[model samples]
Target: MGFKKHLSSLKSYEAGKPIELVIRDYGIRQKDIIKLASNENPLGTSKKVIKAIKKEAKNSYRYPDDSMFELKKSLAKKYKVDSKNIIIGQGSDQIIELLVQATCGSEDKILTSSLTFAMYEIYASHNQAKVLKTKDGVHNADQFIEIYQKSKPNLVFLCIPNNPLGDCLDRSEVYRILDSISSDTIVALDCAYGEFAAYKDKNKEIKPKEIIKKYKNCIYLGTFSKLYGLGGLRIGYGIADSNFIEMLSKLRAPFNITNLSLKAAIIALEDSTFLKNSLKNNFKEMKVYEDFAKSKNIDFIESYTNFITFMLPKSIDSSSLCEYLLKQGVIIRDLKSYGINAIRITIGLREQNKTTIKLIDKYLKR
Candidate 1:
């Protein structure tokens, strides 16, 4: 049997370690495990979203509203955009796939930060498109502009407050890059962690409507997985010019989103008390990680997201540290694959954070 030639070049994405896997391998009790690996909401699902999902569970037998009208309309009113400007996906990840399918071909190129999300390259590779990264490990507008001028990639991904490593490109820096790129290049501005950034600093908010109105080529990607605690539901969206939204929608399979997911996301958007409490607790807990790093004199990025990345000292091996933590029933991300000797941990609940800190201290001291 033969596969597509390009499939040989891609490696499967390694997600966070699952608790059940740890239980089997390390023989740890399920109740003892904590996962700070995937940047999931530590608060768990919101009460409002849970109730809505339960109410909609009986309707799961029927197909979802393929149009996704209500959810898009809800998102539109919140962002002050028209319904046509929005497109829903299984997750913002699916929208990434749709954008790649619509814009990329074997002859095309996709550009992104050197240390950003892995899926941009993975999806681009599925189409055999060339992937280009900035020379700088972190997102630098100057480097992006230089690379864009040289490669003229068909798609550009800007992961705002980027995943794995949580620093962000400022609003001004983002505009500068958008200004430099040609309208022919479709830029996917992924704001998966935008809520955390906005909570920390009002100036850091990436306004989807503002960007869409200013740049016809720009598409803003957002997810319920982060702040909304809807990772399990997997509902996300893309906001762009109605014209671009139409083009992407044509590539989408009918009913890609489930009925329960639609209900959960619609209510998730309106659960203001949950949203506010989650954000407040997020930053409040984030400080614990920051201070922990400072106390150890470890170098860490000034994160604008819910997670923090700690650049370990030469004596601390990221993989070894992660393995040690795994045995103790704690799960966190290792960035060696990202070509960095660091670890990324989600800002968990107070007790989870305390247990993680205690375990790390034990490891470092050992």
Candidate 2:
């Protein structure tokens, strides 16, 4: 059996360690484990969304509405865009794959931040396209503009409030980079954590309606996983001009979303009370992490998202620290794979935060 030569160089995305696996590895009780590795909503799922999912469970035997009528309508109203401007995917990830498939071929290039989402590079490789990154660890408009002019990549991905790093560029800065690119180059603004950023600082908000209305080459990607407590549901959407949406829609498979996911996402959109309380708790707990970092003289990024990335000192290895915590049944993301000596932890519940902090303090003292 022959596989593409490039497939050998590709690596699978290493997700956050699951609790069952942790239990098997460390012999820890399930209730004792604290998982802050994935940037999932600490508040858990909304009651309204749960009710909708329960109601829709009976209909799971039937195929989903491929048109995605209800979910799109809800998203459209929220973003103030037309239903024609939207396309649904399993997650923003599938949409990313669709964009690469629709626009790229061998030797074509995709430009993005040096230390952003891993999927951007993985998907580009699937199409045998080259991936270019900024010299900086995070997104720099100046660096992006320079690279865009030099590489003229077929697609550019901007991960706002970037994952594993937690830094963001303002709308004006993002637009400056966009302004420099030619109309033919497609740009993807991935704001999966946008709701958290917007709640913290208005300037960080990347409005989908404003983006779609302004640039035909641009598309806005959002997900229900981060803030809506729907990572398990795998429902996400993309917003672009009607023409672009139509083009991507052509590549999407029918019934890509499940019945329960579609129903949950629609109700999740309307569950503003859950969203508000989650945001409040996120920032409140985020401060605890910040204070802990400062007390320990550990440097960390000021996060707009629900998680914070702590840049470990030269004395502390990221993998070593993560392993120590994992053995104790506490899980968090280690950025060693991203070539950084850092750990990205989701802002968990108050008790979870305190437990993790005390454990970190113990690690440092040891």
Candidate 3:
């Protein structure tokens, strides 16, 4: 049997190790593990979300509302956009896939930074398309525009407050690309880390709805997995012009979101006090990471979101550090596959944050 050639070369996404998996591998007790790897809410799921999940679990046998009307309505009200402007997916990942499928085909090129999300490349290449990766970890407007004009990619994927690295693009850079790009070139803006961003650095953050409105061709992708602590629930959404939403929704799998997830996300959104406290905790903890890294003389990005990326020294191997941390029952993301010699650590709970700092300090000394 013949398979698509792209299937042979595509690299799969490596997620942060789960607590159970790490415990089994390291012979550590469940209570002893510190998981500051996935940028999940250190607070865990909200109590209101848990209550809603329990109530909605009984309806799991039934499919979610095919239209996802209520969820979209709630999101629309919060974001102050019409429901028609939004699209729901299993996660921002699924939306990425659909965007690639909807716009790209054989030989069509996609543009993104070299060290950004892997899924953009995975999905684009799976469709037998090309990816134009920029040279730097940070997005440079002039360089990207030069490439965009030359590559004239069918799609562009930009991760705001980029993953693993936690760096963001300048608004001028964003506008430069958006304004210069062809109307037909669809730009998919992954705002997965946007919620934490606005609180820390409002100037660098992109306002999804406003940007989408300004650049009618841009699509804004968001996820409840990180800030909402619903990774297990897999709820995410996209916002664009009505026509763009309609086009992408056509490619979305029917009833893509689950009943329990829908309810949990809705309740989670309403729990403003939980959201406020979580943001406050994250703000405080990011400083802990910064101060700790500074004391160690470690090169680390002052992250805009819930994580920090420490550049692995030339003398140190990233994989080795990761293995040592894992065995010590602490987990953080390694960035080897993206060709970066670095490790990304999520700003976990206060205790978890302290534990991770201790582990890294020991690793450095050893």
lDDT per residue as tens, model 2, 1-366? 599888898888989999999999899999999999999898899998898888889997999888989989999999999999999999899999999999889969999899999999988888898889999987799999999998799999999989879999998999999899999999999999999889999999999989988899999999999999999999899999999998899999988999999999999989999999999999999999999899889999989888999999999999999999999989999999999899999999999999999998899999
Question: Candidate 3 on 12-93: residue-level lDDT in tens?
Answer: 8888889999877779999998888888898999998998888888887897798888999999998889999999888899
TM-score for model 1?
Answer: 0.98
Ranking by lDDT: 2, 1, 3
Tell me which of candidates 2 and 3 scores higher on lDDT: 2
Of the pair 1 and 3, which is ahead by lDDT? 1
Task: Please rank every candidate by TM-score, starting with the best.
Answer: 2, 1, 3
**Candidate number with the higher TM-score (2 or 3):** 2
Count of clashes, each model: 0, 0, 0
Candidate 1 C-alpha lDDT tens digits along 195-233: 999889877789998999999999999999999999988
Compute each candidate's TM-score over C-alphas: 0.98, 0.99, 0.97
